[model samples]
Target: MAEETITLEVTRYRPREDREPRAQAFTVPYRKDWVVLDALNHIKDRVDGTLTYRWSCRMGVCGSCGMMVNGVPKLTCAAFLRDYLPGPIRVEPLAYFPVIRDLVVDIEDFMGKLRRVMPWIIRRTEQPLTAGEYRQTPAQLEAYKQFSMCINCMLCYAACPVYGLSPLFIGPAAIALGYRYNLDSRDEGYHLRQPILAEAVGVWQCTFVGECSAVCPKGVDPAAAIQRSKVAGAKDWFLSILLPRGGRS
Candidate 1:
């Protein structure tokens, strides 16, 4: 009996050779346990040595293998070929980003946005060594735990049309992470982060598309975080007007 096979329609782009991305098809052995990443590995190892992409920790933890699979942003490491079987699977570099090569999009913009959000625990003052370590209870940990699961895969960005149109927007992952730090019990940086979050290009640009949450692999509801941040910012703005001198109520 002939071996079963699956077809993969992969986008190919070479800066030096090609003017733009083009689809190239390849057929590989069909395995129920194989993922889209596995098929890509087969292509790289056996078929095409020049193919370019990014992947590490093939377990979906690194979040480096994000791609457009069947027109949806997904981590190729977790996208089982069986789920897309019955024919060819369309794979391309993530949308709304510059493709450096086949299946690899430049992420410098996301890195800049992430840095701008300052997704870290910030303290207004440091206590002496005599002061014990800052500890968090289960409930406190639970407050920001879900948002902290973000691996910065940028799948949320690919799913977000607002980001696609306006690269200046701070974006979902960054806001979600900033909100995560704000919810941290040990963090005293909400005041410092408010300027960025309250900016016109920040959370207000979302337009409630909701696709960011729908495609999140780690269940990080960035849309909710953005909306909540907007509410908080608005309340802060109102309080400042009433109290004046940028006072907190």
Candidate 2:
């Protein structure tokens, strides 16, 4: 009997060689256990050495394998071949971002937004080492635990229409991460991050489309985070007016 095979229609682009991106298909032996990343690896290793894409820790933790799998943002490592059986799979770089090569999108914009949010525990002053570690109850840890699961995979950014329309939007993951830090029991940087989150391009730009949460592989609900941030921003604004001397901190 002839071996079963699957077709993968992958995007190809060489900035210096190709004027625009184009699709190139390759046939590979089909295996039920193989993933989309596995197919790409087979093509690169055996069929065509020129095929290029990014993937690491094929277990889906690194978030580097994110791509547009048949028009939806997904981690190729987790996208199984058996799901789309007996035909071609269209794979491309994540949408709403500049493609550096074939399936690699430039993430500098996302990184900059994350940096602006200050996604870290910020203390007013560092306690001396002898003071012992700052502790939190399980409930306190649970407050921001889900938001902390982001691996920077950026699938949220790709699925977000607000980001696609407005490049200046601070975006889902960044805002979610900011909200995470704000919710941390040991953090004292709410005042510092509030201005950024309350800005015109911050959480307000989200529009509550909810796609960011739908495509999250880690089940991180960034849409909820953004909305919560909006609420927090509004409360901060009201407190600033009601108590001029002692607003939210």
Candidate 3:
């Protein structure tokens, strides 16, 4: 018997050429184990060279080749063509982001917002780099260590409705990084930067829809991070009023 063939309907956009983005169809022969990335590569190499997308660490570690496949945000490298139902699979750039070309979306807005959250450890005292590594207990490390799994795939932002409405919302991925570091016992930015995170479009902006977490390929719980931040923010506020000296100083 001959091998089965799959058809892919990919969205294409060229600012200097097309009036707007449009879908292009490509039918290609495929093996059972070939992933979506393989199908895209097949289209690019044999079918059409104009189709554009991003990819690296095709093993799903790089988190670069994320897009909307069949109306869901997922990593192309991890999404298999065999598992998907037969027919023309629709491939488009991630949602809630500006499309730069075919399947590539402008990620600068996402990166810029990530910087606003100061996703790093801010120490009260400048710890000498020469100083030996800051040791952390198993318990302390375990608390926030899970969040370190974030690969910044940007799928969270794509799946986020808040990001669609407010591009400057400093959406899920960066906020997850914030909670990751804030939970570290050695980190001091938690209290100092609390106000910055308390903005209307900041951590409070997260409504815990769980969509971000749902589409995450790395299992990074952006929703959990937002929830924890909310709880921490409230706790800090209550303690500030209860103890005159224990508050943000």
- Using TM-score as the measure, name the better of candidate 1 and candidate 3: 1
Regions more than 4 Å wrong, model 3: 238-246
Over 26-45, each residue of candidate 3 has an lDDT whose tens digit, in order, gives 88887788889999999889
- Per-candidate Cα lDDT values, in order, are 0.93, 0.94, 0.86
List, residue by residue over 71-186, the lDDT tens digit for candidate 2: 99999999999999876999999999999898888999999999999999999999999999999999999999999999999999999999999999999999989999999999
Model 2 has a clash total of 0
Clashing pairs in 2: none
Clash list (residue pairs), candidate 1: none
Judged by whole-model lDDT over C-alpha atoms, candidate 2 comes out at: 0.94
Q: Which residue segments of model 2 deviate by more than 4 Å?
A: none
Ranked by TM-score, the better of candidates 2 and 3 is 2
Residue-level lDDT for 110 in candidate 3: 76
Clashing residue pairs, candidate 3? none
